[model samples]
Target: MAIPRPGGGATQVLDRSARTPGRRETESALALAERMPRLILESRRVSSTLAHGIHGRRRAGPGESFWQFRPFVAGEAAARIDWRRSARDDRLYVREREWEATHNIWFWIDRSASMGFSSHLAQGPKVERALVLGFALADALVEGGERTGLLGLTRATASRRIVETMAQALVADDKGQDDDAPPPATPGRFDEAVLISDFLSPPEAVKASVDRLAGRGTRGHLVMIVDPVEETFPFSGQAVLHDLESKLSLNVGDAGAWGEAYRVRIAAHRDRLAEIARTQGWTLTIHRTDRPASEAALRLLTLVAAARGTG
Candidate 1:
């Protein structure tokens, strides 16, 4: 939703035609290409805050490290049987190697019209925070010997210059990042994902988008980016609010009267989002633009680790 300027103290009053021009969602990736260096620096800075580095997943699959020994099953390859371990027990056993999605961490950041929103109480636009957090997590994942990429947009890579690689991929795509939801991307079964977005879409639409990610058994995390003004409706009196997505303007008479109802509705919306995440066996995190990006990054690292049974 469009933000109205504070008028007469805590109250806000706006003309029906008032429009606060913002960085449009249709902004091209070419512009972002120029900001790559700065954004990269910000991503690196946020990622460096965590002292504990990620390394491997706790699952069993193709890997160099030993994971566990399980009882050998019939029809299994005899070469897989660990003879020495089997001698200690009545049943034959096989050593399983640790499987890591070291090269399968995927990211998707929403760049819709609603995400371009920035209120006076925030550090920058919601889109900016999403980009920063996405890159920051990718940088950290790369540092941990993992590959990261934009879901349905770029291939996963463990490149040291994560921001540059992702930026170049976006530049080539050229299409406007107008989707409020993640693309219909399927991650590897053992893959982990982080979706950065404002997630203001209706719960049904968001659920459909999320299903695309979870369909392939991808362990997903939803990071909901919000503005402080949106979290706390600090406005009162007559005002006009515009819909960033629909671009429709509405006259909000006595904005003060709607404050409680607005908060309740938003709370219900979040509950629905959380429930959808739970049903899909995913996690949800809320990040405010007013806070440090590193906070969300750290939480996500923990979530990914826990999902992989490392934490």
Candidate 2:
């Protein structure tokens, strides 16, 4: 797309030197490899710490319907022993209860160019926060016995090794791309979606994507990642802003003067986004990079719990 230069001079052409097929795939994989270790360690540390505060789903009740049986160990209560099942084996067995149902929650982490935005005022890039938060959520969800998967990358599963699963998906060429929009296909009915991104795309595109998922009967929770610099507009005097995706630059004179107008526009955009999500019966949340990631993770988990009727 051609972007008009600031002050309505001449239109500027974007640099597409690396737009060839597999170019991004290769670069992204290498970058992920270099950063995977740090990401994993940080996510594990955060998730472990959060575990002490967040509560898991309640266990099945004593009178709950039986699902299976396991051999009873020493110190077991006699009243809990399954006599019928024990008769089949020499060892005594205990009845195990099943959950009411299983719900699959899929996570979509945006790897778009804009997600790499970082400023002196922020802790890290938007993508870093998304990965860490996504990992932590997967860690908690799997611990709670919920099926979790990376949307468009793998099938949903209730595996304790979710961190590894996500790492593999992140490095996979076919699964991890900075696509501008999600794949056209929709998720299954009753499935839940967790979309982590900056949501900097055009309003219509964002609306269409959410509408597609909602039409497919998938309830969703959106986590919109924003850098502190983007939200606060801390520039002064003259400044240059660049669009990461289109590679277009806009020069501003007295950028400090433009802060209010910029903030107003962003606020309106967010309000519109929230309205769209509400219309589709989904939830939208904003997370700033400068804040603690645990906060975002907890808020997201609460939303998911409420949606599943477990809260």
Candidate 3:
């Protein structure tokens, strides 16, 4: 199926062919920024599950709702030491409880060349959709007083003050290049992680990265943004296809002969991803680039709501 173009004057679809003439594509960063507040609000309405899960007002501070107890450390506050428990065990123990202040949300975006694919009928490319979604999510969580951080799989920083900085850096016109690499180890503990990608890489690689994030006890939400062309594998007649990340090319003279095989492969890929998400208890949502950003945002919100047990 083809992606539907965005209607109204809210978004402008850039012409990719124009990039070959040495003219720079006008930056839409400002336009995207301006739409962010509205998107965030809309996201909240759609994603009551996530909004309620993360933003629900809980009792202030480390209270008696059992997180864990640890051996008392030197210079620790005496008030935190559980005297009643200490008397029973004859060993000093400090009550460690879940605190609202420690909750942090980390957002990751994929900036690989594969993410630039967008059908003529679609509103924008995968990368652009991912950026807008990440921005809106971050803005919403931050607005709710949660500490938020941003990371491009190709770039990462953990500063609370620069939540949208990485996304802003990705505003350049699509060059169809794949120079960006995965980020180095990230600093600080993250409570939840949101990953936006096309996931063009092998399933094992994707699963490994996800496992690393999960190892940190971080709940994960993986948003797979794809172009209609990629999902449908629509290559009519003869065509030359290229792997954007590997820089490898394939020429096919008979599109009809390979259509069935291609569909099978795509189905297997999606099934594997779904199995991984199920096993890991992670939320996975797929958005087509041809869909309106508003539609994609609503779907994402629904996923979040489901995660929070609100759906």
Ranking by TM-score: 1, 2, 3
Best by TM-score: 1
Taking the tens digit of each residue's C-alpha lDDT, what string does model 1 give over 1-311?
33422110011224555454232432432256676677778887888886475535534445547778877755344776899999996999877554532338888877666666666788877777888899888887767656688888887765576777776776565454656667777788768888887777777888887787778778788999888887878878877666655555567777887777777877888898899899988999999998999999889988877776632
Kindly report which residue pairs in candidate 3 clash with one another. 49-305, 122-290
Per-candidate local distance difference test = 0.71, 0.71, 0.54
| Candidate 2 wrongly placed segments (more than 4 Å) | 1-30, 52-55, 58-102
Model 1, residue 178: C-alpha shift (Å): 1.3
TM-score of each: 0.79, 0.78, 0.63
How far residue 266's Cα lies from its native spot in candidate 2, in Å, is 0.4
Name the weakest run of 10 consecutive residues (lDDT summed) in model 3.
Answer: 2-11
CA displacement after TM-score superposition, residue 284 of candidate 1 (Å): 0.4
> How many Å off is the CA of 226 in candidate 1?
0.4
Candidate 1 versus the native: TM-score? 0.79
